[model samples]
Target: MALTTDRPITTAGLAAQRQPERNRNVGRTLRRLPGYAAVALLLVVVTYPLIWLFLGSFKTQDEFLNNPTTSLPDSFTNFANYSQAWSSVATYLQNSLLTVLPSLALIIAFGTAAGFALEVLVWKGRQTTLMLFLAGIMIPGQMILLPLFTVYFQLHLTGTLWPLIITYTATGLPLTVFMMATYFRAIPKSVFEAATMDGASIIRSFISIGFPMMRNSVLTIALVQFFFLWNDLLIALTFTTDDAQRTVQVGLLNFTGQFGVVEYGPTFAAICINVLLILAIYIFLNQRVMRGLAAGAVKG
Candidate 1:
């Protein structure tokens, strides 16, 4: 025999039972709306400049003057901006690679190792040394440039690629040490102890255990350092001389002649290409960083 509860509870009874679900849906909908709106606004703000640059690359000075906001070609005339920009841009790009890549490698290698060692290794005055390293972040950029320039002169390294490489690498060390110290410290001490218990020496444990674990943090910071060095014009300008050593920034400045012969087409074209490349790199790495964080949080 089938049985029913009470006097066959009304629709209001069912609604009361599902009240939590309804409240959850309302709360989720309200919270989700603002988050999505924020993301949309941020996208628009970030996109406008890039869109402007890209569209401007296609526009002739006449068209630009006629109507600036229009993105597409007025009549689809052939574009030579990219070609001219490439011809002038590649040389400077190569110079940047030479200076930036080596410096990047040096900074990561030294900084990561230093960070791992400072946090993990048994040593006297470790706290004091770490504190001193952390203090470097407080130093002003310009106050040191003159002394750095003098040192560069004394070493006969000025007007050469080495100066840029060495200076950027060394200058980056402070921040690298600071960040890596924090990340390394976040690692569990027990793991290091286990490695030590396995008869691993100082260098062996660091190489076999510490480095692999810190790979994400290292890559994240290396990219950050690369961006800083890549975009730097002040140090590049101060250290290098002659067209051979001039970076893309100095090269782009050539467009601004004494007269009004601005090469906006080539400049914008070059800039657009770089912006696109940087975007690609950022997207790819950000994905990796996200994945690392998720995996890490889960593992922890």
Candidate 2:
């Protein structure tokens, strides 16, 4: 049998005990109220634009002209704008894929190899070489644009996708190398050493061990480079002379003419499509990218 020395509590005593807890709870809620309000405001800030864009895509040019901001679409089922936009952007979409995909592959391939060699392999001057590569990151793209354009014009590569591909690959590689090198540095050198002792070649060791371990980091770099390439208008417009070679961003210009005439509905539709594509990609890979960034932060 269990015995307890206890005092019977009066109603007033229980109320006294609960009063402090209630006050403390109210105080905590009051303290947190501003944070909740800020989050709600941020949600509205981000969400309202997307909702507006979606609604605007369904509206007619007249509807937008009369009341662009306050008016809702007359019909949600209207899809004429999408058809018009798609017809114009189909080739542009293809061109973007062709250019961005190849550059992405080249960036990853060279970056990973450079990172592995720099961090995993024992060598003199590796740090100096890495510094040289990192220096590229600080150089602004605008500084090289005119020189690159002149060279591309001489080479007859201005109208082709080669300029875009080469530009993206070269520019993206330095940062990729930096990120990948940091990741590779965090890994144990002994792993590569053991692989070496087991008769594995450096390439084999990188392939079998290094690449697999840094998959998440690779994805992060790919996503970043993809976004940069996909949304680029300045470079695409400067290099691409032909309509067939234009990117999606450039293709969106088709809906506007020189006389101040703009096809607002179709333009909004195209913008929506472009944004949704990138948004879908981000949503799919967001978790992995977050994990990679978190791992890098912890390792650093």
What TM-score, computed on C-alpha atoms, does each candidate reach? 0.84, 0.94
Q: Model 1 off-target regions past 4 Å?
A: 1-34, 69-71, 75-77, 257-260, 291-300
Residue-level lDDT tens digits of model 2 in 1-300? 989999899999999999999999999999999999999999999999999999999998889889757689999998999998888877789999999999999999999899888888879999999999999999998898899999999998877899999998999899989988888878888898899999999889989999999999889888988998898888888888888888898888766745878989888998999989999999999999998886577464
Local distance difference test values of all predictions, in order: 0.80, 0.89
Tens-digit lDDT track for model 1 on 1-300? 978575877899999989999999999999899999999999999998888788778776666556656557564443687887888778888888898899999998899888988888879998898888888878877787889889988988887888888888878998998777777877888999998898998788888988898888788888788888888888888887778887776666665424858867667888877777778888889966664444334321
Model 1 clash count equals 0
Candidate 1 versus the native: TM-score?
A: 0.84
- What TM-score does structure 2 among the candidates reach? 0.94
Candidate 2, residue 188: the lDDT equals 83
> By lDDT, who's the top model here?
2
The per-prediction tally of clashing pairs is 0, 0
Question: After TM-score superposition, what is the CA distance of residue 103 in candidate 1 from its true location, in Å?
Answer: 0.8
Pairs clashing in candidate 2? Answer: none
